[model samples]
Target: MPANHRYSARTAFLLLACTVLASCGGMGGSSINPVNWVTPYKIDVIQGNFVSKEQVEQLKAGMTRDQVKATLGTPLMASLFHADRWDYVFTLKRQGVEPQSYKYTVFFKNDQLERFEGDAMPSETEFIAKLGKRRKLGDVPVLEATEAQLKAAEKPKSATASAAVPASVPAGAPPASYPPLESAKQ
Candidate 1:
């Protein structure tokens, strides 16, 4: 190629690259950028022990470590350095709602719980309400069959068929006798 032609080609390539880079840099902080309008889906993140108010209420001044564990579940953090202290930490991160975190610490003396303190835990029902999404529910349809529907479903049985079957067992009634689960050996 001619020297002038080669120089023009290099300049054109550099200009194109600069234009592309400049456009991208402008989008970095622009509100009109696609990234600003459309966000990738983020899953809820829940971690560590979740102790409810009811469980905390069960704790007493001299409860054993085993009892405390049974009532409030295992602690999230228990270090050898803090052998007598049990720490329960819970965190929840949801997309639209604000993040939630709670920490509770239990101090023990002579292998028994001496005292406990931390953030006030929500009740089970309150926590469940917080987790549910806000939406309007439609009216529920009636599920039970009417008397006319039940009568229409019933069919008259022939006398011979009725005789063949001794009697109809009532609904939910246990069988007169249950056959042995295993076959008898000859």
Candidate 2:
């Protein structure tokens, strides 16, 4: 064989080997990469509920199982062997953002909340900020209504309900009056 032919064959074999290797890297659903410049889009890897500080604060010793469940939704794990223990776990992984994980366990005594142990939880506001959602807090006054004001608030301001609410008033402002839907049939 000519030297040129042998060299060309060797070069072609190397190219094929490199291409095969490059494609094989991700064959097993693996994420390993040798050279990855462009950021490969990775969907946010959210696994569990993002338990907020408020939820943790709501937990208190002596709270009933029902109350605890109400405060912090259903637990992630409830072992049959450990019937009195409940576990709450949350994890988040977003592109460009640091990963976060939380593990909380609540122990029950006689079906009542005994105590809870876990990492420090963040408040809802803080969690939202961590998720990169920044928004200006509404500059709204918190009024301490008098007895008369409270009474008046119960009455619907307008005879007809209006969706166009004033910026000052929060949405879902209760109607002024709520007559019985169906009066007791005499």
Candidate 3:
């Protein structure tokens, strides 16, 4: 309410604003943020049971192993290396895509019977219960390298200077000239 008190408060507020602004100005130019965390619990659940809409109707649990496989087809990867667990990973991705997968892992107790699991990962019984019918399989996928990628894959050679940076004439520079006397007289 007093004049000196009001002036002091305004001065303190301005100093605080300047300090905050100065601290923040450098952050916009940098590539990395100082604070980040990547705990497994906080990670995205890209993995899950993702059956095509048709498979939605017929999938039911307690179906025999053969019946489940017939409905879902073979697991994406099975281990002769380990054997018991089967991984049926299906992704909903577009062309030229790197879609995240829904990893439905089935751990068979005997390596033949289903066991416990991580979430989004379905029980084999659940997957079977979920599969209404067989969905048609599509072509296997591949990524073609870009031109820069192919060039980078090639062995590096410093001798190919022209290939790396072709010489550029200055924007308004005149073309180089030969002697006019000889060319013109002849």
Q: Please write out the lDDT profile of model 2 over residues 4-107, one tens digit for every residue.
A: 99999999999999998888676665455544435677888888767788888877899998899889998889999999999899998887767889998999
Query: What tens digits encode model 3's per-residue C-alpha lDDT throughout 8-77?
Result: 9999999998887677666775444232222233322344335443443344545555655676567787
TM-score for all models, in order of appearance: 0.58, 0.52, 0.29
Best candidate (score: lDDT): 1
On lDDT, who's better, 1 or 2? 1
Model 3 quality (TM-score): 0.29
lDDT of 2 at 166: 57
Off by over 4 Å in 1: 1-34, 134-186
Tens-digit lDDT track of model 1 for 26-125: 8777876545777888898999989999999999999999999999899999999999999999999988889999999999999999999999999999
Judged by lDDT against the true structure, how good is candidate 1?
Answer: 0.90
Model 2 clash number: 5
Alpha-carbon shift of residue 31 in model 2 (angstroms): 19
Candidate 1 lDDT at 39 equals: 82
What is candidate 3's local distance difference test score? Answer: 0.57
Lowest summed lDDT across 10 adjacent residues in model 3 is found at 35-44
Question: In model 1, what lDDT does residue 48 have?
Answer: 99
